[model samples]
Target: MQRGLRSFIIIWIGQFASLFGSALTRFAITVWIYQKTGSATALTTGGFFAMAPTFLLLPIGGALADRLDRKKVMIAADLTGGLCTVFMLSLYLNGNLQIWHIYLTNVILSAVEAFQYPAFTAATAMIVPKEHFARVSGMRDLAGNASRIFAPLLAGALLAILDLSQFMIIDLITLSIALLTLTMVAIPKPTQTEESKRAQANLLQDVTYGFKFIWKRPSLVILQSILLTLNFLYTMGNMLIPAMILSRTNNNELILGSVQAVMSAGALAGGLLISIWGGSKRKIKTVLMAQVLTAIVGRVWFGLGYDTLSWLLPSFFVFFFIPISNGSTAAIWLAKTPPDVQGRVFATRRFAAQFCLPLSALLAGPLAERVFEPAMMPGGALASLFGNVLHTGVGAGISLMMLLSGIIGAAVSLLVYVIPLVWRVDEILPDHIAEPSSLIPEKTVDSDVGVKAPEGAASPAD
Candidate 1:
């Protein structure tokens, strides 16, 4: 590998360590919440708590990222997240833990992450060459997918075999190591321009400027909106999956963990495939195909029930497309946007995509429990509508929803595709707008900073 690429790899490894640790604790916390409360709502609290804060703070975070040194922003975010974990771990270890505690800490960490994301994404654009963007995104997602496979399984086993508090301490240690490793790396930051150095503008207005930028870009807006819709469905399915599995297998941990691992493993493989193949030359084709695959698997997986060997077939097919889709979508963003404006643009992108998660979680459980599930059950009310083809059962019901979702998704995809205006990811959006990195310059204190990779170390494209 070239020197820049090698540095990017090293930096990415440090991030992987951080991701693994975070995943470990996250799994522990999620399980602890669910097992303690036995409420689906309780179980998904982390999802809301961890994400809502970031959604709320997107505008500020996006603007800050544009003004600051990306490396400094990321390193600080990591250190802050680690410290938050340390404190939370201690509180739990001392025998004082509550649902509110988890919620509050999640919000804090997530707010920090709000800053971390845009900076890291924008930094990648600056550091990595265009050709390697796809592979780098795949590699980044591969690390996350690898963690998803192992972290839950490990957490499930660890929680079973060891004290939650003790295992949590291990996570704390990992965070410290991640922060320390980051301190050793160097990532170049862009020099400040005159406009970047001028008197500070209103934070809200700067953010509004970003809004205008995206509003003017039809392709970016449509893609973001479509992703929002798709993720809405995806999260809905996810909410119901645990309940369905629990019904079938008497809520077996091994089954749950194994299934999760299998799906993530499939996604990991997809990431690798995309890393190698990059994606379709006509990016719109890749997106539509991914959507079609989603609709197919979403419709089929639920129908398969818990068929030990066969159940994974559709799940694998669907999941294998996710990384390719996600990475390809990211590549479109990276390629289309310039290095300067990406921070704000992508921050909005992330924000819009996740903004509805809380609402989805809030509504999906009840809908499935009282509405969809009952309708799908044998001889139930809605069975009359779907009774002939779908049949009545948890699997059948979920299948109906999936099929419907897929059909809707396909419709949505094609609508945007043929419109021509929204088909191009790059046509409307402006490239990254250059800005000074002095707003949050690198700190003088070396110990406080994470690894600072030399400037211009190129990362592999996905």
Candidate 2:
């Protein structure tokens, strides 16, 4: 293997372990919270707390990533996250663990992630060659999908045999593994440009520079707008999947779990495929087409299917395309944005795309419970209108919601694709050229400042 890709694989192994451990802890805590309170609202409230801080703090985190050593920033984030787990363990051992303590810990960890994500993303661009951006992104998605597939099952099995405190120790161990891997690798840093030098002058400007960067580029603005709209619409329907399944299946957890497992498996397969194929040459087209397919095949089928097989098929298809679309999008930005400014640019892109998630979370339940549910009930106001197509019943309203989201999402993606700016993004935005390393000698390279590779070392693409 090439040296750069080899180094990245080592890091990926540690990160995969860490991600699995975190997923296990999160699942265990979610079960514990629900069992103790028996209130979905209380459980959801903790999630809101966890997400709120990350949204608010991401720009600041991005700024820090740019100004600091990316490696050190990641190490600090891992250490803080590990400490949060330890704090929770201590509380549980002392019999003082409350729902509030979990919420507090969630908030802290979310904040740490705000910093960690940007640094890691920026570092990946630094070390990997441009040709392999999509492949690496697919690999990252693979880790996440693998965690989703296994974490819940493993956590449940362990919980049956061990206490939550003991389970949490595993998380700490994973964090140490991540830290060790990070310490061993060297990440290249971007050579400073005039734009970066000016950005460094003011903290506030650094935070906002990402926004300005995108705004100046119409193609990027359109891309972000498309993603933002899709996220808002998708989240509105996506969050209701569990409710729809449970209600339709008469609260059968087995069917629900089976469907979820299939979905994760599909995503895992897609990620693995993309990692090998590296996506299509026209990444922008790949991204848009994937969304269209996801909406038409996945969401539309989900709303129409009533049986277990029906749900499983659509769920798998939806998740499978998601990784392809996401990997393509990451590759687009990685190539277009200069490495020195990627931390901020990428963070802003994420913040904009996901800004509506919490809003959708708030609205989806109320819309389903009050408006859609009532309207879809037999002989209800809108039942006669949509009844013939949707089959008015327990989850029929949510089915309608899903159907509508899919239609709208598909239409929006197509509409955006037709726009010249978005359709021709690749042609409009030129790729950033990598600076030659001859200017900075290997003997003088500093880890904090950044290193291009040691002399004679091969990069990922090579």
Candidate 3:
């Protein structure tokens, strides 16, 4: 293997370890907070603080990724995140840890991740061969799915034997591994284009350039819209799945865990398949069709099913297509956007796609508790009409919500797919060529404006 590819592999391994460690910490902290406070609001509040910063800071992080050494940026992010963990550990050991402290730590770590994410994403595009972009995206998804699959189990096991402080030391160790790997490899910088040079001239302009880049391409805007809509619908249903299952099963924790594990396994399996197959050549079609399947099979079928077997099978299919959809989308962006501007562009894409997640989360609970559940109860309004179909009761309202989200999501996806611009994105947009670059460029450009696609560059659509 070439040196750059080798470096990417090494970095990926380290990042996988780091991601697992972070997941473990998050799981443990969430459990701890719930145990101490016994308040669902507290748990949700912690999550909100953790996620809010990433959305707010992503554009700034993207700008910095373009301007700074990507390796150093990643290392700094890791170090900062590690220190936050360490701080929490110290507070726990001193018996002074509080819910507020955990929430504060989550905020800081999330802010750091805002920077870490874009740097790693842009660096992958920089170091890996363009042909391998889809494969690399699959690998990235695999790491995340693996973390989600195993972290809760591992953290629960460790929490049985160890306190929170001791558990956190493991996270510190993983962060060190990530730092070591980052130091060992050299990441190449993208060669400057005229647009980048001009964008870099003004700090404000640099920060906004990612948004402009996507806006200039009508296809990308529509794609973003589809993602945003799907994300909102998906998150709303996903947030309630556990409640739906637990309520129906009389708070069967084991069953809930089993369902979650199966979902993660499905995602992991999808990632593994994509890694091997590198997805279909028709990347946009893969993205849209996957959404349709995810909504129809995962959400719609899942909602219609009332038993364990019914839920488990559809749950697996729902998560299985998630990685495929996400991997294809990543491959699309990696191919279409120029390397010099990817940090900003990709960050912008992430911000747009995920902006509705928190909103959906916030809304799902109330809609279920106040509106859906009440309406689905026996003799409640609309209960008589849909009762025969969904079986009016505690969790039935959430199930109806899931069913509606799926129908709407599938309809939207199919609608978007038929639009000539969205489905034909791969044909309309040109892939950016990955060129060999020295460790340091002779001159650097900061702006991403008006960089023409490289000549003879192949489109993934072809």
The best candidate by TM-score is 2
lDDT for residue 251 in candidate 1, whole number 0-100: 56
Q: Model 3: clashing residue pairs? A: 195-447, 196-446, 196-447, 196-448, 197-447, 199-447, 200-446, 200-447
lDDT by residue (367-387, candidate 3, tens digit) is 888888899999988699878
Residue pairs clashing in model 2 are none
Question: Tens digit of lDDT per residue, candidate 1, span 1-462?
Answer: 644456467666765665666667766666677667765556555566766787788777878888877667877876676677777778887889888888888889778877877777777655556766677777767767776678767776776777667766776676666666665655456544443444237887778656776687776777777778877766666655555555445656666666666767777787788778888876656766776666566435544444445455565554667777777777778776666666787788777766787666666666666777778887888888877776577555555655566666667666666766666555545444433222233452122123322111011111
Q: List ranges where model 3 is wrong by over 4 Å.
A: 34-41, 156-160, 242-253, 305-307, 377-394, 436-462
Candidate 3 displacement at residue 182 in angstroms: 2.3
Lowest lDDT 10-residue stretch of candidate 2: 453-462
Poorly placed runs, candidate 2 (over 4 Å): 33-43, 94-96, 156-163, 246-254, 377-379, 382-396, 435-462
Please say which candidate is ahead in lDDT: 1 or 2.
2
Model 1, CA-based lDDT: 0.64
Worst 10 residues of 3 by lDDT: 450-459
Ranking by TM-score: 2, 3, 1
Cα miss at 298, model 3 (Å)?
Answer: 1.5
